[model samples]
Target: MITKTFKSESTIQTLQLVQQELGADAIVVSMREVPAGPIWNPWKKSAVEVVAVSPNDEPQVRKPQPPMQMPPSLEVAEEIPEIEWDIPAKKKTAKLPPPIKLNLNPLSGQPAPVTETVRMTEPTAPSNDRYSPPALKKIQQQLTQQGVESSLIERLMELSAETLSPSTLADVEASKRSIVQLMGAELRVQKGAGAFVSNNVVAVVGASGSGKTSVIAKLALFFRQGLHKSVTWVCADTVRTGAIAEAKAYTSALGLDLKLVYTPQDLKEVFNGEQANDLFLVDTPGYNPCNEKQMIELGALISEMPSRCTYLVAPATTKEADLHQLSASLGVFNIDGLIITKLDETYTFGGIYNFARKSNTPLAYFTSGRETSRNLETADPMRLVSALFGKEWNK
Candidate 1:
């Protein structure tokens, strides 16, 4: 059996070469598109990579042969020697030596069996009496006393014996801790009431249904009331229904200025004429990742903004594949940080971990409940780690 991979822009050329080399017995295993050189030339667009397996060696065939007839011998067989035979070897009953006992004192110079070394190195099997649920519960209680959460302990206990073997349990815990370390912390509300006012210019961008509008409203209240910053809400979200009106209504109730911009030029004009004292918060349209036109349009608008883009993510409703796809599509825009919303709805923190890991984006804020701006917090790794393992923490 032979396997080979070939790359060629022309399918005919690749197939001809493969057939010539493998004697037409080659089977194509797979084909994949790969980037080639400059795109200015149509010939350099891409290449097809073909993987093939060939079996050219033939099995050896043997020639059939005729059997021969045997000649007869007429000699009488000679009597075989009568070997000495003792029934049951005369039933030997030799006296066995008495068992030797070793001295218990350490001073006794006696060598131990090599099996002792193996026993010391190899893992010992658990005794039948040691496989008690109560014993496991006691161990769980001890781990809880040492600050491990009871829920995690119980989950570990519920795992099958093979899954939760002593060695495997240690490995699982170590992996969990490593994941927590990488994810860092849970998002916490920004400290210092005046900090929100210092950086009043904000931009929110993310996939559809990620709660950007709700987050923008919460921030509006936070800055207008909590930080006492003059707020001007700008809407660049022309694609979604009720997006501009929703933002306008929310900001209007707080006596904040709301400007609706249809294009990047409109945005520049509005920002240029805006009051210096007012903090401008731009709301972008929620984009479907699959819509390349929308993404390109939104990217252009975001690029025009003076402030960096803060991507909003809804962890509770986001599936792993969707999150990854969303991240890839949004990568066109320079995503500065992330804001995770709808944390109150989901218990699994794996999505959060996976998102942060895949995107390499730092968590900026997290919204646990549908509270006003005060409920949003800066991300804290410890809180997230505790929450992921179902550990109770001081709220």
Candidate 2:
């Protein structure tokens, strides 16, 4: 029987195509929605794929063959005829060079030379494991060890298996690069803080102890020292203990003015006479995601700054579910970017990638180490990718 597949933007259109190709009495074997558009466009709409066949088509049957009678006694010839045949010579193909290994170092902030290579004598053997072709199995294990969600790791393995050729899959280094590139493509890093400083007001909010205050200090130095812009520290975090004192200490060291605001009106007054060129970095109070009252109050303060570029500060050590809950709780603020903190404390960072994927928020910066000025780094996709492969973000 003959069958055909049809794809269209809509189910109705797919049905029409099936009918056109297979006639009115067509039977649909399967129908499903598949991603459409170019590979680079992740936000592309889905299209319907339908497999159909005509009902009139019938399977061809084969007739049975009659058995032939065989001689009772087998005849053995004393002399066998000698036959000579000419066989063509086999063509020799040139061997291709192995792919270069890439080192993922987050501290260098530059591409480093490959420090390791796969020795031919120690080649990875193929396996019957679920995430097989040993190279891909290694990739899966690395991702899992880095605390990446199991579902995402499986998806990455599938992508690696699908995109890499058998020869490439045999090479662990090539498979590693392919998997890293796949993750890097999904990560979205926004322009540096200097670019967003033009928005005039920058705000950061998070749960208590998420290093929100430290991130603010780092941003202050980044704008003042790095970008050469005047920065005003606004403290709206009245809920957290010592939050005000911490903000003051950071501001005092940076030689920047600090504005203390307890209410939305106070925050409004602080921004009423803001300078056009000066960057205002606002620090918000930490609130529990489960506390509706605190969330409402926090949202009210954020509403005061109509032109603010808000960032949701998340610790790298946060679990996937908690990260999702935090983002969902603060999603009402229309989070413009994400700031990942506490990178120095944890080794795994796959949760960050998962959060970015779910929220569709671009990462702004990543903070690590104890030093404020040197710790803040503009979000780098390769850095996160490096961490997923057991390379910690050292700097």
Candidate 3:
């Protein structure tokens, strides 16, 4: 029997080649898959290597050779005693396995061809979404666990996948970079952190426990100490207990004044009495944002102070659906932008990013912890993107 090795781009091609080389009597003994070229070209893939042998024209006779017989006398075997046969004295030899084969080509570090049961596909260009970068699966799982909505997650994946060039898909790192850049570019970022400062009064409102009060303190103290501006704290949160004392303590500790107001007219008078350049950081008591009456009431109270900018304070760990509702409900208040809180508490900030993108509201400020006035800072797209990904990402 004569044996030959054949290689082609696909299973059908390999079989055709076998038929061409050894004619109709050719029998495939082995087959395997290998990479197309150096660097694993995704455009060209799934080459098959087949080992085939030719069938004999006729069966050949196998004559059994008689076993060697030793002479009866010991003296006759003295000359042959020098030879050693230390192998097990079995009557028959065990069939030897195929010789060790190793293919060490630089492009493909694989073992030599051998028999295989699996079929190989033809050479085909990278198709379908399966060949997407490794980062796609990683980001999908990360966002899914972070409580991002399935629709938003799917949209993000689809958008990023569309941006992936053939070259970008080949390198996962590049794919990750491209996606981050694309998201950041499409994002709505407002650089005017000081825009609200320019106005006389800044009214902060949000759901109860949304960190509205803490953000108020941070903004008031940050402006007073950092920018050396005169800031007055106002408490419109008459409902929640200790809410008055919380605003008073923060203001008094910094030698600033705090005002308490119950009605919209009361807040209107306080702003009316304040100096022209004084920064008024008004903190509103948090309430269930889903309550239409509560939101309308809050909006009316904020509408009292003229030249005021309203901000919807929210936490980063909030659910995506809630974030959307928060954006929509706060729209009644004529919200100028958003202030994201609790950065250090959770790793995910994608909900906020998506919220800002969907709401078309700029992220004015964000904080890491409840530091009196220290942890707060202006928003940066790169930093926010990095926080969302839970890793370093290029903008």
Winner by lDDT:
2
Better of 1 and 2 by TM-score: 2
Report lDDT (CA) for all predictions. 0.61, 0.77, 0.69
- Candidate 1 off by > 4 Å: 1-200, 225-227, 391-395
Tens-place lDDT digits, model 3, residues 88-127:
6766544422332222121133322323333445688776
What would the C-alpha RMSD of candidate 2 be, to one decimal place? 25.4
Off by over 4 Å in 2: 1-131, 192-198
Model 1 / residue 250 / CA error / Å: 1.0
Per TM-score, the best of the predicted structures is 2
Query: Taking the tens digit of each residue's C-alpha lDDT, what string does model 1 give over 1-395?
Result: 77777776655445444554553445665545667788686776666666666665641222222222234765534232122323466685543222212111111233211110111246798775535344455545544544443454555556433344465344645444543453354233334323543344688877888888788877777666766668788888877888867776787666777888898899888767556667788888888889979878887887777564455565545876788888787776666667778877766655665566556776666676665545676666566655656663225
**How does each model score on TM-score?**
0.52, 0.65, 0.61
* Count of steric clashes across candidates, in order: 14, 0, 0
lDDT of candidate 3 at residue 329, scale 0 to 100: 74
Q: What C-alpha lDDT, on a 0 to 100 scale, does residue 107 get in candidate 2?
A: 27
Pick out the ten consecutive residues of candidate 1 with the lowest summed lDDT. Answer: 111-120
Q: Model 1 — TM-score against the truth?
A: 0.52
**Candidate 3 Cα errors over 4 Å, as ranges:** 1-130, 147-171, 392-395
lDDT of 2 by residue, 275-331 (tens): 767889999998899999998999889899999889999998888899899988888
